[model samples]
Target: MTAATVLVVALGEVRSPVLESVTLARTLGTPVLLSLQPLSEADTDALGRAGVARALVADLGEARHAPAVAGRAVATAAEATGATVVLLPTSFVAKEAAAHAAFLLDAGLLVDVATLRLESGELVGGKRVFAGTWETECAVTSPVAVATVRANAIVAADAPEAVTTAVEPLSVDATLPRGLVLDEHEEHPRAEGRPALAEAAVVVAGGRGTEGDFAAVEELADALGAAIGTTRDCVDEGWQPHDAQIGQTGVTIAPRLYIGAGISGAPHHHGGMQASGTIVAVNVDPDAPLVQIADLAVIGDLQEILPAAAQAIREHRES
Candidate 1:
């Protein structure tokens, strides 16, 4: 059999799955055509240079998601391109889309793929499940497979010999589910300048240990220009928004640096961040679970420690 074609589900964001997909695409072969939803011209241009030969842009009008539509369309496109494997970003929406497409094509579905290898005759993928403790290998039974890769799991390695390919624009029509209205999208003002919470190099997170005051958390995050995240307790107790939660039920992130303040570091909470490169904790209770996993554990109230740390970081940055 000839080299298998890989269809990558792209995020189309300014700095995300666009680079991620293209990198993996080059690893598979030369022709890495990107399928985009909606993004700026600048983003498209940048992606174009990243070895994306084609852009199969699907129009969904003003509706935020047309999953069924995109899923079917991507599956059809993949089949036509003779693709043997489909890859998607492991985000909430991309996960749903890839699974749906795999079902439509009767292909195997693999989630949370961390590492991939194109062997002599077969493709192998590595997965870390159950809060980064167990390492699992996934080898599909079907010829056509669908997999979603965890963010930051792979480096973007592009080849200089990549060339653009022709695009066969795909379109779809379907009725969406009820009460799923995307009336308007207020772009996160910070999205343009600040790093995304999931993509941040440094993340500052707070938990129930902070009690009700997140002032220190905010100050520290501001000083570091880091996105603020939180544990489930902070969300459940109404001290923080649900978006801030980081756990099995919340967002999973693999940032370079993660700082925990007033967070007890439950296993469920750590599950979302155990993949982080560096972990620091500041908790009054020395017995918190975070202390065990933390590279640096400080036994002090976050309220006092955070301000001092923030000042130190600021001073270092200035110097």
Candidate 2:
């Protein structure tokens, strides 16, 4: 119950879980900062403003993310601070690094933790089990516990006092994993500039009824500062990327708000976003399955309703 320090892996810009992780650390102990190798000044400032007690900028030089190298960087920071707990955002990069860090430090790793608390000096975590239908509690007995927290799952309140954070540089000397050199990269343009689907607080999803056109969906999503999603049919028709598909066979998301447009609310698709806090369905069919579960159901032509809704929201926000 008496953790000396909690090391938090900073997600840098677009950090969805920073406040949540900071709050979690505050409940258990103090938070120390660590970023991916070759840390940026913006990320350092972000950590300092969030009231981190101290930061360890890992200088990995050229071998930035050579699997074990990332783990070694984090492990070194944890050891230096004598950290009892390590909290990281449930992001793709952080999750990958956490897996390796757990092995290197021999810590108990908990992934997708939605809730955690410190009771009698014991860290108890709650996570989803059996396809997000059931909740399971987990507790670690190891000296160092590593937990990856889901985004937007915790409430972050502002601290009462202004904290003066200190930054310390810790250079890590790690050998790259053999045969894991970086290959050439190819960057392609995306349809819209929106947040990652899983991490977004709001999501606007379309289905087969979109008719190969996602203008309305994208517009509404962008207006609400939300992410875009699609059904399996839309992806199959090449209207959206496979990463945007939300169904039983695709990615699962639990945002604060979910808007389903031109969707029938199939069982498979519902399984993906059933955990959403609020659902708003816009469909032509009055009896669409999505309408049954939605908090607000709009029965109309999506082509007309979507644009009008987006415009109204834009105007309201501007006003």
Error at 197, model 1, angstroms: 3.1
lDDT per residue for candidate 1 within 41-131, as digits (tens), equals 6655665667666666555554425566557766876776778777887777777878778988888788878777667555678888778
Q: Please give the RMSD of candidate 2 to the true structure.
A: 2.6
In model 2, which runs have C-alpha deviations exceeding 4 angstroms? 11-14, 38-41, 61-67, 184-193
- Pairs that collide in candidate 1 are none
Range of the 10 consecutive residues with the lowest summed lDDT in candidate 1: 185-194
- TM-scores for candidates 1 onward, in order: 0.85, 0.88
Write model 2 residue lDDT over 99-217, tens digit each, in one string.
88888789888988988877666778998866567889999777788889887677665455547667778877767777777554333344566777777789999998889889999
Question: Residue 121 error for model 2, in Å?
Answer: 2.7
Maximum-lDDT candidate: 2
Task: List clash counts for every candidate, in order.
Answer: 0, 1
For TM-score, the strongest prediction is 2
